[model samples]
Target: MNRIMRESRKLRSWEEMKKIILQRGSSGKDVLAPIDEVFGRKFSVIVDEMPPYISLRNGFTGYIADIWQIISSELNVSAEFQKHSFDAGKELIKNGSVDLLITPVIITTTDIDEIDFSIPIVKIWYELFMKSSDDGATSMSYIVTWSRNLWFAFLLTICILTATLWIIVNIRLRLERNRGKTPPAWQTRLDFWRGYRRWAKGPEPENTLKNELVSVSSVGSSFLFVLGALTNQGNCLKLNSPSIRTATLVTLFFGLLMYNAYSSVLISRLAVGRTTLPFPSLESVAEAKTHIICVRRYSFAYVQFKQREEDKELLEKWQGLVNEPPCLNTTSVRDVAAALCYDNTLILETPNIVAKIIEDYNRSNGCDITRLYGHYARATATVLMKKHFRYRHHFNKMYYFFFYFFSFFSMMINAMLHGGKNFERGTRS
Candidate 1:
């Protein structure tokens, strides 16, 4: 009982000492080093397999490795490196097998329960990966121009209805039935409108005729009405039935709206040709029926899909893409990106990571990854540490030091080393 109390007292005193050390650590005292050295302890960092960010094999090497080297140097301590896969790294950090993670992990809700993160080390953008543009105009070009499949259905309904009208008019003509007089040969536009106005107001009854010519004239009127709504022309023949006129008005209304929408979209697309931009969005991806190749599970791309529980269509696409043997290599994301060099590929990945992959790729293949959308660019990604990590404050202080002073320099140096791939942060396509 006495020993238990004494041990508890020791734990309290250690916590008090840690608090004091953290206070001094941030105040430019380098106080953490003395404690770490006195305890003969170092942080173990689990590094994941992202090159140009953190490459861990025989030893740590990459942008993150260089940064960690500087941080360790400044802290007057060394971090032991343990190379692991991304999921394994997360599990290792969560279970306290490691005190730190060299891999830059995105801060997520799931992570909140398992680990603590330093202040953001870097910001990464999300991208919608898609295939190279194809120049051919398809029968589906109306999709881009109309922006909805319902419009196509509506137009098709109009065509079918018009054809039915034509057939009915032909049958009536063959039966030699007519109840209206034919228009004068030299009738003006005003005369046609005058006659239509009378018909809609319930025209006076007159002598009926059973004639094939009247049926032919009705067929001509049906064609005229269809042409006026679908194109820039109007039918002059007045329909006698109230129901038929209402249906014609419905067709005209839809036709007017569709014509305006289609014309505007078509002109814009023509201005910026399809070759310049194909598959502008996920909807386009579905319409184009392009193959989906995802890099890894729990990646930012999948995270976005998970967040969009309401988007049933996109969710379905995501599920379908996952059901195969290595639509992508599950281990290395870079390998999936490298696959883009040959296969028609659209892959969702963090922009900075793939930008490096593309840089390395273009050196040999002269290929490029097309970005259709940028997601999660503002998400905070930081170094992961074990849950309730004793030295979180200490590491956070060190991270802030690097973030303010070295952050800009690191980005500049990277951009200089590789040509400028500096895209604006957080802009969605």
Candidate 2:
């Protein structure tokens, strides 16, 4: 507030002081008491210009105004809500110009030493949104069939319906032409109409059924149904039934047992034939016997690769067999994904930077890398905070709350979208 104090503090820029007042900068001390005493009044905090905290009108802004009002009322203080760009908000807090920085701000240990924070207000979960490739390649052309197990099951049903309907139509036409009569049952007529409707409208049952069935069931069930109809009527029966019985108790029992045994073998065979299969172990990928994989340099993945001593030897052994060594190296994640786009055997590398990469890929229409590799690739977003900040406890609480909240909502939305796609895919497959 004064020239002597400003000079003694070695305040560098207006931008820094502005961030300091807002608690946005990571390099400033809390001058709240001093500022309040000197100004003889409560001061304002700097925040972003968007809603949930502060808004213009229209729809709800999630939690901004609520937080501002609560902090002000409880502390017997008032704040001037200054709207600025996200970067400017940080600058304001850095320069000791604002009293607090309140918005959905990420706080980490590195950030604590510079400026104090209140409890974390909110947290976020991230995901990758990719333009799906047919054969795991970058483009769609390489995809021969996009079979979701659910879709396959549905397709099986369509096939059975089509065949049974064909048989009925033949019978009906023959009876009408020769015997000059309708089919014996009305159910048969209904079946005919249903099949006709499907044929006319396309293979899908109808929008209403699609929405209802897909919403209620898991993708796997839908797939089983489709597969059952396409391959054989008995397929669905076996999937739905744990056991079955027949009239010729002894002979029928043996026959059913044999059918079950054969079906198991056939199912395994079908699973093997599909192009999209579970990835082999990192050891296997490292071996480069029949495939290639991209991994980050000096990263946990690279470390793991090294830890698997046998796998390392295998890579060296196979290096001479290929036209060139299959090692693709790059720092940028997008570039690595691009490399994976064209290479059939290559799997791209993903490091522990989930939120940042997910947001980028989603906005950029890049690689679909949502298929996480278990604990091996868990990336966490952390807040960088400064040391000795007065409000660490307050910030941590807010941060944790947001972390869980955003993660839950984000996953829910993803699951909803995933279910729709999975249903259609499962049915076709």
Candidate 3:
């Protein structure tokens, strides 16, 4: 490449070309460097098909894209857009398939070795999302509870077990009137009622009920004990049989845990006034009680955070939290908002995606989303270019100094040119 460049430079007077550029500056066609003039019909870029950024339909609606159009017009060069992925654009820059990438890709430490990036174009902020309260036409008005399907399943299970217990006890009853035994049918029925009453009320059956009978069937007591324990308001029903007592103790322990969980979830939801509760911060999200099915693309705060900050405690905590897979991995950030479409889910993504979602939902129910945590870890998206490209410094200077820094001046000049053209057209008519 050096040999070819030397041969090329020999043909053109490099000194004279430099003098012309110095006089005219970037404002005139004479300022085009030998490198710029080499094969330049139009300076085209490999545009990644990220809508609002670069697309056939949107053309270049994003702020950075608008800025690019301004720069292109200033240089008196037409920009031809070619669509490609970020990876493809990087590869193109490496092999010189394209001059540069127009789409703004976030500048990360990992990318530094491969390609040089232009001056930071747009400042980006990270955001999170949860389902809106007004998700449906009629918002959910019920207290926090498990889904109806779960309740149905539990009821079905209980019914089947209770029926089986009744059948078994009836079949096992023995009627032996010869040895001071009552008729099996009457005795089994009486015992079941007495035992169940004892369990539902208390071991002091006389106090729980005005009248009491001597309990016989331990099976009835066991069944009633399990049911009452589930509500955490069980009677002090102690079984004489060791197995029955042990089972009762076990059920009570599990019931205590379940009831506590249920009550806390209901109370918290009531306080929040929504099924989904607001988290204190991004870190608090990890410990949030709401079991939301989160979804995200690669452009997420957690990914950036884990990659950059090496705080062992934080990394370890986040790593372990995501192990349960808080958010489903997606290829596009737009799809991350799907998490917010559901009942209990969240998305950790950039503000661009959040704005897009809100725009789509504007006329309808309106996005019930809130920022909650922050515009944390402010970042910049930049244009990707070949490492040590001849025009890197010029491109940076063009935006930071000429185009972006003098944006107000450029806008006025553009408006004046547009107004003059319209007036000329009117005069021609």
Best by lDDT: 1
Of 1 and 3, the candidate ahead on TM-score is 1
Clash pairs, model 3 backbone: 294-327
Cα lDDT for residue 81, candidate 3: 72
Number of clashes recorded per candidate: 5, 73, 1
Pick out the ten consecutive residues of candidate 3 with the lowest summed lDDT: 205-214
Model 2 C-alpha lDDT per residue in residues 1-429, reported as the tens digit of each score: 223223324444544333333332123444243323322235656655333234435432335556445334433555566666546766666666766665543433434446665543533332112222343333321232333674476446455544443343344334434532334677667789765775688653333422333332443443444444333443222211111112113223433554565566445545544234444444444464655555434223433334352343424543532223344543334444444433334443333233334543433334544343433433222222233444445435444433333333332343344644443344344
CA RMSD of all predictions = 15.0, 22.3, 21.5
Better of 2 and 3 by TM-score: 3
Model 2: worst 10 consecutive residues (lDDT sum)? 239-248
- Between prediction 1 and prediction 2, the one with superior TM-score is 1
Candidate 3 lDDT over residue span 1-429, tens digit each: 223222223333434333333324434443435335422346658876554455445456666777776666555557677877666777887777677787645545666777788887776776666666553222343432556685686567555544543343333332211323334776667799765775688543222111111242355754674567778778444434344445556667767876787677666656665533456466576676454434332343545546463332335545444423434455454445445555555666666656765664333324467555576445566788877776777677556644323433332233344544443343345
**TM-score ranking from best candidate downward:** 1, 3, 2
Q: Which pairs clash inside model 1?
A: 126-375, 129-346, 176-210, 176-211, 228-233
lDDT of 1 by residue, 78-164 (tens): 667777777888888888888887665555765688888887776666665645554325545656565457667866777786876
Q: Give residue 49's lDDT in candidate 2 (0 to 100).
A: 32
Better of 2 and 3 by lDDT: 3
